[model samples]
Target: MTSVRQGGTGPRLIVHLPCAWDTSATYGPGDTVFGLREGEKCILEVAGVNNGRVFIDDVEVSQGEHGRYEWTAAFFAGRVQIVVTSSDASEAEYFASVGPSSEKVADEQFNAMVGEIQKFRASLLLGSSSAALAFDDSPGRNKLDSLVGLARLRLYAPGFLREVWEICRAPHRSLLQAERRVSLARVKRLHPLALREPLIAAAVAGQTSESPSLELLHVATSTAVQTFDTPSNRALKALVTRLAAQVSTLLDTVVQGGLGGELQEEESRRPRREHFLRHLLKETKVLLTREPFCSVSRLETSAASLTQISAQPAYSRAYRHGTRALLRGVEGARTLDHLHVSPTWGVYETWCFVHILSKLAERLDHFGWKAIRHGVVSAAESYELELSSGIRIEAHFQANFTAGAPPAKRVGWSLSRFRIPDIVIVVQSAARLDFLVLDAKYRSKRDNVLEAMESAHIYHDSLRVRQQKPNFSVLLLPAEADVPHLDADSFLFEHEVGTISQFSPGEPGVERCVDLIADWAMRDAP
Candidate 1:
């Protein structure tokens, strides 16, 4: 749907996308074709030049005659760029905005996925016992790795800023006792200790026997005044200041992480991300200049102040939630620092792992289960959720399982060279250890689903745990519509291998999958 016209004598590039609808016109640095569903084939035809090469997402594509390049890629969501370069170095760029086929609102779905990831990262920060939970050790290190954390900040920062601004506009004030010198006639409540000196001076001046002159009797009086220098206000200011500093740090990180270099020319031609970060920074700066935040002294954030804010009916929601989210955002930025600009499939895969773990935790709670160790699993770069009910769920994200790998790294022996699954769940109980291999495929197409199921088959047949095969090897797809009923019945449920369609955060389908897995784990519980 996107049409590009070269300004001068250069190779003309036209991209034909398989979009379900045309909602808007072309905009931004590159021409964008909207409503392009995920897993659809797109064609790029370049004319008026020979020996020209086409690149989709910076990878050169094999082209046929007439410079026609067809791309039938995997489950790719978000903006994808197509660059066509001629032998003379003339280049034309076009972008394709791909969305989920199941959901109409692509941004909402993507934001929801990011929110889930943030929640997961937050849980790790609180539940992790190992030192490997450090930010530098995060998986998927890339220059744009901070984008995910930034996206989370962008999603919640506006509301947080608004709340802080509102609080500053009418900040909490309390009556504070103060001492000031006042004339005898004006002093309503004079302090006895402070009046002694004035009385002694009056006696020395021969005024003690008679009514002391109002002008001569200057005594200190204790009075109360309503001021904004309360503990809650100071805490509010501290949190806002911390928020501003963190946001500024994030902006600097983005700029230093090559936002305007290769990302500018290749991946992100539009300055939307940079612009968003700057806008957030501006908002935080403006909020800091408001009433209480400007005048109130900084107070170290403590549990008592936070609890006070939460206990107050007026400031509870805004201050309490704002402070918690600010802290969580900081932790998320650190923990998920390396997860920026991850592929859509990677995002979905991580979401599945977190979503399943959360649901399993809830399920285990019914059986009086408590978390014993929740954090990174040593140097393997995996997350582990261990419960007191003799159940430990360790998630291996894109881990290599080869014969030569260490025991901690290898889930089970694979007959092949190396089997790297998207997510591998190892449920260790008192009686037995069960392995559940889940392959997250963002693609919903029938062919892509069948191809993705091959991984489930491979894990089921090849992976051996103590000479026993895996109990369950499932393919986690995006939505229910992605899998056909016939295929689900004939190929998935009939065998030990299954398909958990609609396996996304906050989706109802997730409960069924969680129950299935939790039941399997609880069966081996002693």
Candidate 2:
């Protein structure tokens, strides 16, 4: 590990990962430490600063003996930023990349997983053409309330801004023709009608029409001038201006409201967010000063003008996608507010559920199962697929379940208390209803995998469908190395609890898991 000094003064920051093979590394601002495994704990010590505070991913770390601060990497693979602030106001920033410990899984593979999750979320919303999925009104359990604002700034704004720029660069120009008095020499194309007026004026002025002083002679010439003040251009300009203002207001609300502390931590423990906002504001102002935007006479965004904009191919893509992103706001189902700081476990869980549900839907289709209702579950952060074969698959995002709740709200009731499994598959036949509960555990370690299996056992024992235990309960874990302890066949036959490891997108085992569930559903079908 290479040591980098911070400002050539102040304190020296040292990082120690007791779990890793190379246990120690020195880091400074803009430095990244690699080879750290996900779920591993690390220690940070700041030399030369006795009373300083340490923050990892914006959460302050508790000081231990000898002024060492510890933080555990999250279960998912991603990069986390750390900041150490001294009493003298000096700060040093560092980053750590957590990857899968297994040699079988490459670092790119884990990074690609995160990317795929993000893409999946965007596609989910984009694909829902007319689905009325509302934004989250309340703060999420993750406490990042203004996810819509963050999505506007982070995900959608860049592309939208690029499209706006493209429109500004070569905007749709409209030709304007006006009848005005101009010198005879200025008329490039001497129209006969223009000459008639000019000859009449020359005759009145007592001068020869042909050889009259061109400067002295005037003509009623019709001039065609290309201008950027078209209705389409005005509409585009209006949209950009309104979007910029709305984004500014949203940022202010997010920074000053509940998301203040969290966003501050995300912005490098400094005023980096302020700097970014300021840069955006400046860029927007500059964009407005450009040709089309500036030349637009009025910021009137009428329906007809907007329709005109959509008619042209050059402006349609930006207008359509940008308006959609703005109007849809933040999806409560896929909250990406904290993705920059840390890719939360909920994201991984949702990805696993979607993957399994998709594969299962494909298998069911092969068996001639047609979807009756396939869309987002109303008033909830989940997607449901109801097949013609009486099988309903639901992928929930942190939905709650309680024994006292209504039947429509509860996927399955807990005999003792409440249970909220990550994924649930309920198959209702004419005779009986069979349930398959799946809990996604983002752990790859042996101990963690075993601990997560307890959830499966608990769900299998407690959750009941029509006063009966689920036919099968499974734990979906990240890696396959440590889950050989729980045999799938015996657990399903005797205990009704099992584990499916390495159940990720594009994994070969995904098909097998989907097949197993499909087989059970087919067997129970009426």
Candidate 3:
């Protein structure tokens, strides 16, 4: 619970929010969340159009998402004068108000609606296809559609925390303001794992018969290393190690669509390089009109409104972690070459789109779309360059070699044009480099590394390019995940070059896979 004191001609309005549901929780005091309430009268500022004061009916008003001024003030008694200023500072006025609570819902109703929505969405997710989510007209066909707290932008606590921290430290002349932002950001971003992890593990282990525990999804999600700072570096690294497989989806998206597809279109109406997304959007919109089914949803559907609502939040709008990935998969429509596409693989889908968006957003050079507000990026401003470039030299072979044949090899794909691995790594480095090669194996579902190591013979044989040496290779292994237990050695795969190196990427529980790979690239540099 939080409390704030506000000034008025009448008794001070001391607002107490137990659940912290108000936007004031985000912006701090002096925001409208507390200012507008029953029996309140105050002048409301309307400035953009012109400096004008509107006498508001406070009791009848309600607050909007991100819009605080959309409220009324009720003054049964003599009005108290308070200066209301437009966000632009163009308008200011004096007035009075009773107080504001018109926007706050009954706590019980608010929670029930959230529960209902989660339950219903959880049910829909289990279905194999959109057809599986048809309108049954049953009692449970749909859940409560409460407009308040509808779970859109259900912020990750970390996001809120970080935002609060920044707001406090904003460009105010006073350092105190900045300190306040830092405090808020910390609150939101603080690790909730101690409270959340055990439940998440139980959900993962139990496999409940009812709705799939979103807790597992939350675990996978909250488990990500999305932020970076010297202080949080340890936790970030851990998340990266655990979430490495998840991050791969992002790179796979780039391999699919040229991340700059819009930049290469016919040059007549081409905007700036930054406006590439604008072009993509124009193109996608055109496609939506001409080939709607082919472009986004694969199936032809009669749920036009539902489709429109679903597609309104473009693939680019979500957080950097997965927004690009989801968009890329939707636009490119394929997996990372090796994985098969499945309905439940929305993780893979969203993953690809977010990654692509990250790349495209970083490289865009113009600001036209930023002003127009298509609602894709966080702002019109460009994103920082991607810290990690997801690329590698991949050589895959579809055909196995004949026993007596002098080995002829095929390179499925080699990213030599831009990226080349400084060191060729073999899985466990056991296979003779000339005979087989394994990059990195990341399937906890598999019992032992031996299966991956044994399979290397086939991959190694395919790579039989008789180099000067025995073509020995190296396997990159996570030192923390049981490098010792795997009994890996340079000779594990029957080659001198085979080896294992152990180094945990981050703290025990917080790092991601990409962070670990990045660590390897840093440490592995010769």
Candidate 4:
């Protein structure tokens, strides 16, 4: 079991988790988990606001003193998955391993999520119309969400690999033509040398004959050459051959490595990639045959000519876009290690949630509400989405508590001057707007949850007076089952800030969140 030096004054709660749980094997007795004790003061080391969440017996425990709650189950049987994570389907990484210091992560779920996300991403890269809805189509907007990992940026990989396969699938071919050029030189054989009319007459008639011309034979000659044997074509051939070999090697690595066991299942499913590699290898072997006229000098000359030919506008333009994309795709093939080591995807979680929100918005088609504008507001740390009917949703990140004036609540200098709310979605109607201030607390300990509620309250009040619209708020905590709701309401009591405390922005949870927001937005709709 992994162990860190245990010397801290922060309150620590001893949670008795089951050994069968993923991370549970890292700590405690034979069947039970251990090290952390009940009613001991300790603190959970977290990197950022969205680092992790702690749950006891599937129910989330908020930040607080150890004495506040009794851990009677320390000696009993139970389960706990530490470091619960909610991530995008494409890039979900939950936990490491189970131990005294280790926590549980959702591996299977994450893999399934990734598979689904890749399918969608692939469709988008292929220019599918249905996939267009996943992105914001507003003018000057990025084709996809910016808050994504490196994997989604693989538009070039498929195309580049396919090009490689096509190149190797046959003997490389180039346009072959007999080119004729005029020359000025006297040669004994005039048949091969295209003779001018006067030179021909001079050659046909002896020098003593009348009308015999003595002009040096100016002639045009024609030569037949295979374009494929040209240095430019050879260079292209070399590049494709190298790429095919490298791709084959990489595919083997991916298939064999299990990507540290993260992608074991993926190895068997991608038969198409493997199949293409086989054909490419076979074709590359066939095309490597030497041409009859390819002497050392000719080959050297051809190689020298390649640089100039490839640099020309026609060839360069073709390779620039495709080659760069191919390189990026190749790099992406090695990203398995990065996904496993990093604990958090940071604000990408919020971005994933935004995607879910968009899906929910689209579901409102029966109501004649379509997403018209959804894009990142460059000036601020906020993203906005507008429906066809005039309803607008804007999510602000780490927003300050103010509309345009001084502090509304002078409870303390810290709470008064600025209140940090993780997410503040402003849903505006045609005539007016409303606010849903949600604190996306990764961990829902008593102290953290209370602080979030306080901030939500202050933000709701601060904006309510200035905007003069209904403002509701909620404490968004990552948990197993829905936790007991606390008595949190806005200062005006116009709306209640409840808990999406247990639900995450994964699948069903995101849908549930959408239902809640849609119901709230349509509550007073015309």
Candidate 5:
């Protein structure tokens, strides 16, 4: 058995799973260890496999003694946990390790990033849930008391809870309409011929010879009716009922864990948040057992028919007014593949930082959508912002300002090229545009710090506009770095270099930095 110590030197991440049937020494049940990096290698080792199996991210790797499993960390980043389960043993030990690699973001920053992204994602899931509801007032009711975390369970577990609810409540009206089919037979009574075909067929069949007045002349007909028990509706009923049972079971797990109440109680002072959930569950059971059935797909087959039945209005309610369409814009979201997993923490942190900065800063007016870059030659995305004081800020991300045309056509294009800043704040005030470039370095390693600062300098020197110096060229890193002089100066070409932590929004250092940046933007006002 390899005895790996905590916090080993070099770029390494190690987790020691203590020998216990229930290992909660390092992490609680379902809790994950942080500081995972991409493009590295990971190894998992089992000390003893008495009757145990080891799993990583829910995928079984190996079992038995001397079992060593290895995988590349390129595709997997974010939280990693080790689980060892033994049927015939009381305790089992496991150890997982990752090879040295570039330092990823701090744990606090990563958690904050995940939380921020989860906020919007949660709202989308809740909206989808509301759409699945059958009542007219459900949107308003859910707005007052929907638990998004519970709603997100639909993402992790693939099922049709919403579709079941939709069908159970309304039960496609078209399918409910009863149609009668008439057949001819030799029988006991004669009936008025709304349709003469059946009577004529019975007469021609020579039933009259059996008993002249009462046999062939008297046509008997059997009526076959269409109902929910028919094959089409029955198939739909089977599917929805099965899914409802599965979803209800998963919901029970969430309820027992008490996840929904905690999240909902935090949002509202109302004590009945859990009450609403109980009611929903009860309704789900009743709907699943109802005799009448309907197909959700058939309801959505036409735009006009659905509207006539008031079903289309339900989806419209899912979209929040005056906001970007979250759930509606994405295709195949019914299966919820989009919301199933968390994005990489590095990417998420950058997005959260920009979001917080854009929202909190009083000077800035507007910010655009995040543009994801796919290749080196791809054009960088710039968020457009307009200040109340007639200043326009174009915030570029990973842009290479030095790779463009020559100095003859541009101003101060001196450096050779190839510099990509994490965020480049280009302030356009009056006739010139000055830069306040930033690089969001999540890792606290000294070498990475130097590289970030060096890149910031390249951007400042290469992107000069006719003697107009940069307001500030800063490195935005995690708070753990404690880089010196983060809030010292912001004057153009005067102490313009510094560091600002991404986690330092309300902190004195970040407040001071934003104040200085805002003050500098207004300093040259005409």
Candidate 6:
């Protein structure tokens, strides 16, 4: 309790104000008050004020152990008044303001930051919960800039809730370990934004990391909650949910100026703001880099920002639209050379785009003719089908040989597998040939049918399952090769991959490859 003496000779007035959420009750480890999901998001505001000039006054409060919110002002005189209210009206107020004169109040500067934080928080609840959604009205990079502002000021706010700053960061190994010995609920009280920052930053520091930090906010009638679930060996789950219930219009009026913009945004790019970013960077920030299955990829990067817009719906729709648009635009690229390539890069936009496409094909609940299985497809074939259109079959496949050390081990698997012939094509019903296995060779010349047949026979007889041998085994080669067919139909001169001698072994000609596979499918059935 912080109170200022209405009448007194004390150098400082002792004014005791109430902490937020006094009635709704403080949070417990399992309490559902915050409703925070593992990946759920909401922009948050955890603001504090010090009017009493209380440097020694350690105002301590918390939602759990070690997660304490403590901030000290200039110094606690014999008396003072200090208070912390949310940007919203009437949720939960955390405060104790002390001052020599009861008239002394919260600084308008502080109030303005709270106001901006509130506006952003309010906006999160408006549309939907998914941040990656690409809606027309979705909040963009601007939300990150605004969130940065709150991140900056909140770090130094006069209450003793300082570790909220660190906890918000990626989390220091030593400090967190030390915190466990303290108590519980001491950690959840800090703003989720404050807690989320460091985690996002680590991704930026990694060998490869760069992405936008988006806001995910959920709003309810009296309160809106932003939360994350942390796994613990001893604890079932740790859910950190921050709520703002006891907000006043007057206070919201005070702290609304702290929200911000993106690194390159017109406002954020200004030279004057360089110091602000520098300060944020210097403050030991961290942000959550891992955002799988969620949008608003709030990963930390080279820059620090405080923007907040609940753009879940906006981002998703935008990404879907944008990718589809990008794909439609790809027809101009006639060859593989046109695809962007950078050396040593572990990931790329192309990869992300392809993955997202798979996500789309899956999500719309639409299954195409692809449901029909075709003969085996090569690795290149699988890659092509996903990217290319028109003539196609199914079983998007890949052919790969696991390598081994010694030469003995090397020729090992490759020879045995290759023994059966690389492919089998089918057209079905028309041919009663039973089954046809097509062996593709780089050699422009034909193989010695008797010798090759003997090797293949050995491989076939080894098949664990016994019934009947393949009705026909094919050997496709260049038109210039010698012909030897144990069974007259067993061997044929067919141009597919390339001339036998000069053929590039791995590159399967797309059309030729498909025809060969379809041939096998038709033959193998009977």
lDDT of each: 0.60, 0.62, 0.27, 0.40, 0.43, 0.25
By summed lDDT, the worst window of 10 consecutive residues in model 2 runs over: 125-134
lDDT tens string, model 2, 1-526? 5455444455667788755535566655667666677657787887777578877654678999877788777544555666678777767666677765553355665555545544444322221110111233223233333444544464456677788888777889888997788877776766656546746556546787366567776778667999998888887777778777866776675456445433434444335445446666677788899988888899887887888887898788877655644543333444332233224354456667656655776887843323333322121355556667665655454445566433663445677776677776766656666667788776667777778778888888877755767788887766674667574666557877877777765665577678788888788565
Tally clashing residue pairs in candidate 4. 18
After superposing candidate 6, which stretches have Cα over 4 Å from the reference?
Answer: 1-299, 302-420, 425-435, 446-455, 459-468, 484-526
Q: In model 3, which regions exceed 4 Å deviation?
A: 1-436, 444-447, 466-470, 473-494, 497-526
- Give the winner by TM-score: 2
On lDDT, the candidate that comes out on top is 2
TM-score of 4: 0.41
Models sorted by lDDT, best on top: 2, 1, 5, 4, 3, 6
Q: How far off is residue 305 in model 1, in Å? A: 37
Write candidate 5's Cα lDDT for 1-526 as tens digits: 3333443222122233323223222322333343335554444443333555555433455533445455445322333434565576332222233222334444454444444434433321222111121111112112212233333332321233444444456553433444344333443344555337654655556654453343234333555443444443344444444434544554554455443323442334222224434545565466546645522323122445334334444322321110111112222213222221222433443553454455535444344434433212222454555566677656555555455443343442324565556665556767657766666665555666766677667666665435554667776665545455443454324666766654343334456456556665656655
Model 6, range 182-206, lDDT digits (tens) per residue? Answer: 1112333344344344643343355
lDDT, candidate 4, 1-526, per-residue tens: 3333232222222332333222212221112234332222223322222433443322333555532222222211112223222232111112212211111113343333333433423212211010011221112222222111112213333444454444444423444567564444444455643434655655665653555333544565556664545555455554545545655565564346432212432344245334544655565455444331121123332446457446654444433433443332211212221111111222223433444445655766533333323222111245566566667666555555543453444111122354555555666676765666665554456665666567566655654424353256665555532235463223214456555544443535456566766776666666
Better of 4 and 6 by lDDT: 4
Taking every candidate in turn, the Cα RMSD to the unseen true structure, in Å, is 12.7, 9.6, 34.7, 16.8, 14.4, 32.9
Q: Rank the candidates by TM-score, best first.
A: 2, 5, 1, 4, 6, 3
Q: What is the lDDT of residue 55 in candidate 6?
A: 17
TM-score of 3: 0.20
In model 5, the clashing pairs are 11-100
Residue clash pairs of candidate 1: 127-374, 128-374, 128-375, 145-340
State model 2's lDDT: 0.62
TM-score of each: 0.47, 0.56, 0.20, 0.41, 0.49, 0.21
Candidate 3 residue-wise lDDT, 233-352, digit = tens: 222222222223322332333334322213322122122212322333343233223312122223222343334324423311212322222211111212111111113122112222
Q: Looking at candidate 6, what is the lDDT of residue 2?
A: 25
**TM-score-best of 1 and 2:** 2
